[model samples]
Target: MLSRAARPALRAGAAASSRAAAPAATFATLREIEGRLKSIRNIEKITKTMKIVASTKLNRAQRAMTESRSYGETSNKVYQSAETKPLEGEGKKKLVVVCSSDKGLCGGVHSGLARFIRRRAATEGDNFDLVILGEKAKAQLSRTHAKNIVLNFSGVGKDVPTFTEAQSIVDQIVQLQGDYSEVEILYNKFINATSYEPTIIEGFSEEAFANSPNFAAFEVEEGVLPNLREYTLANSLYWALAEGHACEISARRNAMDNASKNAGEMISKYQILFNRTRQAVITGELVEIITGATASADM
Candidate 1:
């Protein structure tokens, strides 16, 4: 039972098993780290590409926004000169049009609009009906104000809006069944490259426009006032869409840039971990070999 041959064989077998277990566990950990590093690097690439695309689109969106702003102002001059204001006429409810985009990955661009609506409901009371423009707002509002939604449009905010799209939206709105006293358009106003705020544009009903105290002062233009309603609504809608698109692009670019930076940080951290783990593995193997040789020599 105490034979030298059996003792040496037992010692070598025990050493082999212990050494094998250590390397297996260490190698498994190494593989896991490598997999994580690869995934993070891929994510970084995606975010950087997204940032670049958004940057490219931002310029065109801003240009369209500028032109639409001037166009909207010119169209509103008649009403502005006439001092037209929205009236709370005869117990009729007001309507709100929330302008938002269908896509996400831009920070709070859609949620901000939804938050503004909720804040208004909390302070002003939920008397107005909603007409949401984008799927994002529709989903967000449908949770709380499902009953208040009167109309909604999808597939919007994919690109810079055209006048025809605005006209089509207005046509559907005009056909909706409800004699709203006033209509208000809510959208994100682009303030700067990195800032946006929720703003409202007043949309008056025909009766309110005609009944304004200063409406009589405007020079009597034949047949112009009759078509002005649709024209003004479309112009304002197009302006809102353009500016909102610019804000979305700017926000997306910023969001993607931040994501890419975060990914870079993670990659750096994991790379360091990988290097340290590899070094430890090598050292462990050398230690096992040296210990085995010394043990064999003693035997």
Candidate 2:
């Protein structure tokens, strides 16, 4: 319904309306972006804290693992020197222990270990049964290999994984192995601050048990070495716990770093959008003022 003379004015009004909308849109977008950035910053803070905590824990864990490794190695050497003892009866099953974290937000720490276990289960066949150490591992492994899972223990956290805890799980494994063939542990090994890899540690085979030369070289009384069996079991479990803790920290650090990078990118994008919107508003106002001034001069 606008005449020729009014058309320019109408178009200018619409442009002004659009220009007004630009600032609002920019503000809304900025708010959202800022909110996200804040959230990411918070996440980064949390992850950074976790990383530091993990680092401290990792140092302790590494020391524990290192100390335990010597015992395990010594045990292995001794077992190797000893003659293999035949299984007294028909029990012969493979037991697998899976170690993971109870908590999440550490990136692929849980999934990576779970994937490794699932792959091994597929290839290793039905002879294997699982004992899970963490809730994450329990939840994940239960999805696919529920049938193969024999026992589960949760609530392990940053504390030094004790021999008591190991004894509880090891006793079960020993009982199962007494009826089966072997026992193994699957866990993450911390290679460095930025890297972790899955590892599997296996117990001695029946043949290895029988043919080990180091076992024969031991001069201890027969029953005296029985106590050493507990030590060996505890050492192995401690190593797995230490390595798992280290992996957790490394994964958290990487995850936080990625989050921080993503936040930076988002903040930059929103800033560009705000600048463009501001420029559009200024250009619209300048055009309106110039048109009005020319009309007044002509009048």
Candidate 3:
């Protein structure tokens, strides 16, 4: 029922629509694949850089932690021995020093430490106070344990945590002991480059100070024990800092490695899709070209 002229126009319209749809479909496919590739590439770069930075920091942190462990062990032994002779002080309250990292992007290092603190608090009742190191810890603990937090220290990084910094924190803890009964440290201990374990260390109140068998070996002059006590506090803080740093580096390294691997897989999948889309576009063009040549030759 259609006129000849109208039939040609309709066929032409259909051809145009088909041609347009072909390229649009191909273009859309290519664009989607390309976008994913770009995103994956960006993620890859970030993860690679993070891995390198973590590796560098890991070495230094490990060395510092290793060097400090001897001091930590010796101090613990000394403290155990010193528990024999009772000294003068008053009251019994418990203080906890929790160490974490200032920054995130590592996995659950901060959350794990916070969980440990929460569990301990639940078990220990409401009598304990907290001295938190790191912004991450503050943020994590603020939700539920904010009231127990007595102080927060932030901005500790890859640089060797200074003796002065440790001393100041220790001084604050000692001051708190005058009001409280006891002091304890909760932190991640560096077991290896890949592993860190949370641990708790306890310090005695002034009244509970005693001379034990280990203390019996070293005869100290008057006023020396007080100086040694300060040293012990500082040393413990230093060890905690080193161990926390090591744990941060380890977590970061693992996170980055996983990110990089995922990025690589995404890039591969996108590359395959892009190649298939381009091939489809080429095939469509070749079919149109061959059909046109046959018509021209017949004419």
Candidate 4:
């Protein structure tokens, strides 16, 4: 139906048109792949940076935890030797001081503490008051235990927790209006570099200490009892805070490391897919050109 020279040109034009449509879809897919790759690369960078930062802080946090733990143990030795236990005061509730942190991205550190509190409340009939030491726990517990939250402090565990911070927090806790029979400091205890669990250290009231079965064994001044209680409370809080900070840092480092590994795996997968799609597109174009040439030669 057409002249020979015209047929070749027409076939060439048809081939060009088909290629234009086909590669449009292929190119769109390629662009999407490129965008995803770029996004994943950026995420990997951010997670790597976070991991490095967490690793750097972990050493300091662990060192502080060791010192604080020793100090706390020494403070509690008197109560232990005195055989002091929490007294069940009439109409007095127990106080739970949760040592958490403001920053997140540290796998399950805050949530574990919150879950422990919820379980304790459920089992114990919600007879305890709460004092949260960080925004993360406050946010989590506020949803379920808002009424129980008597006091909360933010901007905690930003670095190695200092005695000043713990003392200030303990002072505020002591100032709380409730008649607390005993104080329990809840925190994440580091089991190892890769494992952690929620734990508690007890702080007894002066009255409880006075009534201990072995209290007669130690000689104390009349005014020193109250001071000792307060000092031990501060030391317990400092130990909890320092250990919890170390756990958070270690957890964050591990979480970021895992995230970066996952991102790398995804990038590798997408890159393979992108390359295959590109190769298919190039092959399709070549096939179209060959088919058109064959048809033109026959015409």
Best by TM-score: 1
Candidate 3 clash pair list: 81-212, 85-210, 85-211, 89-207, 92-181, 93-181
- Report how far off residue 124 is in candidate 3 (Å): 3.4
lDDT of 3 by residue, 2-103 (tens): 987577667666876788787887888788888889988998999999999889887887888888887667777767766533333544457788888678
Q: How much is 206 displaced in model 4, in angstroms?
A: 1.6
lDDT of each: 0.90, 0.69, 0.77, 0.90
TM-score of each: 0.95, 0.76, 0.85, 0.92
| Model 1 Cα shift for residue 144 (angstroms) | 1.1
Clashes of 2: 20
- Misplaced by over 4 Å in model 3 are 84-92, 210-226, 287-299
Local accuracy of candidate 2 as per-residue lDDT tens digits, 1-299: 76888877776668667767756775676567567657766765765676566666666766766676665566555554574443433446677788886888789888998898778767866667888888998898788989988888888754766657777777765565335555677888877777788887756544435445555566656565546665565567767877787678667667766766776676677667656766775676688679667755754
Better of 3 and 4 by TM-score: 4
Question: What is the lDDT for 272 in model 1?
Answer: 98
Q: State which candidate, 1 or 3, has the greater TM-score.
A: 1
lDDT of 1 by residue, 1-299 (tens): 77987888897899899898989999999999999999999999999999999999999999999989986777678678878887766668888999997999999999999999999999989989999999999999999999999999999998889999999999888777888887888999999999999999877888878877788787545466646777888898899999999999999999999999999999999999999999999999999889989988988
- Candidate 2: worst 10 consecutive residues by lDDT? 83-92
Q: Ten-residue segment with the worst summed lDDT in candidate 4?
A: 7-16
RMSD to true structure for each model, in Å? 1.7, 4.1, 3.5, 2.5
For residue 35, model 3's alpha carbon misses the true position, in angstroms, by 2.5
Cα-lDDT of candidate 4: 0.90
